[model samples]
Target: MGGRRRHARPASADDLLSQLGRLTARVREEIEVQRARVELAEALQRGMLPSTLPTAPGLRVAARYAPARSGLDIGGDWYDGFRLSDGTLAFSVGDVQGHDVEAAAYMGQVRIVLRAVAAMGAADPGEILRTTNDLLVATDNPLFATCLFLRFDPRTWTVRTSRAGHTGAVWARADGMCGVIEHAEEEIGLPLAVMAGEAYPVTEYRFTQPGALALLTDGVVEGPRFPLEEGLAAVARVLRDGVAEEPETLADRVMEVAECTGHSDDAAVLVLSHDGPEACQTAGAAPGIV
Candidate 1:
């Protein structure tokens, strides 16, 4: 009989099964890594926001923000409001150095650290900014940003304003008129992190009575091919309607226009009004929006 080439009992079924198991484990590990990456990114995104806005006496704040459609635009834009230890209502809006998960995380750190510095630096808006600038310059990332800090006394309707490289805000009165709030004559720039210990200036404005103030980030008005000046003009037009009786309503209306017709970027709108009790009552009714 011809010697049949010895064939090992086709590699044992057990060995074959082991090989398949190894392949399956590799795929599962890859998937796990992918999932972990996404979860980490999302958690980091959530960390970008302030835990809660401070509620000071006679104050009502309504703020809304939506990031890019695909969600990752955390770009260092942050808004913070609180009652300082000195009993003044403090608010700030800022945009940081970059746009990314890392940027957002850093933005949160900046927000908290700066808040501590601002709260401790006293209610002087300019001093708060000057200190923040020094801290930013000294930080490891050396990240820069543009910010506007305002301290307003509801009892008097007097607002102390400080601008450090940011788009200006607008104040709308009860008389159906509006205009950009301007600071004293001074160069408007030099991002915070660029110059350590540089002095920033502050200006003040008083609304004869409680009215509405609309503050925005560049993203609120500028996107893609949209001309910034034109977008800002559009914002001015909305404010022209002058919805002081219902700031939150006005906030929603303006946001609707942007989401429906304006540029696509991380957009935020805040309407702070001294419109008083009646306004707050109707504010909840500022038209329904999902």
Candidate 2:
């Protein structure tokens, strides 16, 4: 029997318990590190967005951005509004292709490039988007993004918009009629970075009445359990029925409805309200309308 000297029962049960405790501690430490990384990613993504919406006389601007629910994957949905060097009020909403840190980083790069291009006096939204696409392609950025870019002339209540495979924007007239801006087959250009020289056409919409234009990411319309049409119809209904009196209020109310109905993706909405003739008289240079 002494020959076997049975292997000391694989350490005592207490020793095994101690080893298990160490393993558990290691796992907890790793989990904490992961949590910290996620928090940092979220903060960086938020920093990519506008700290404050730019002020444009005669135009009331409001925007909302909601990330996916806690513990869910992060996303790259962004909204931006600013006054260009030439006094053109530019607004944009975009969604990058993925729900990860890479997508978020790409979004930041795209947004920065777009802003830079706009600042360089790229008057046409279509041209701005085209240049952005070219830049992305040149950089070998593999990610694609859908974006709606609008250039608004507060003086004339005129809007020039370009779409790059993005959701159509909804316009609510002063008379309460809400409808989507129709884009011809050719007008809906390919998403950015899809082709080296993709061309986006500019579509013009004049606000004849004191209404608002709503620019949003697909996440706002495509709910978990509904088709795209259904989601768009829901949004149209919300606009038609009158959700809130102010642009910000309306944005909040619409997002609340979407969330209540199980919208799981990230959602962003930017509402720009035209004050009609009464408000257009505010001081501003008559910038070149696209």
Over 1-290, each residue of candidate 1 has an lDDT whose tens digit, in order, gives 99879867787899999999999999999888766654564467566665666654555677666554434344667777877776678887777776666666776776776688866756788888888778878875756778888887655555787888887776665566666776555735456778877887777765553456777777776766556666666676676675455666767765665654455456666667665444343343222110
lDDT of 2 by residue, 1-290 (tens): 46755665568899989999999999999888867766665677799999888767667878888886655366889999888877778999999998778888888988999999999999899999999999988988778999999998766677899999999887676676777787898889999888888999998856655676788988888866767777777776676666336787778766765675466678889987666674443534133211
User: Which regions of candidate 1 fall more than 4 Å away from where they truly are?
Assistant: 1-42, 56-58, 70-73, 184-187, 260-264, 276-290
Poorest lDDT segment (10 consecutive residues) of candidate 1: 281-290
Q: Residue 282's C-alpha lDDT in candidate 2?
A: 56
| Pairs in steric clash, model 1 | none
lDDT: worst 10-residue window of model 2: 281-290
lDDT of 1 at 69: 48
Each candidate's TM vs. the true structure? 0.75, 0.87
Error of 1 at 247 (Å): 2.9
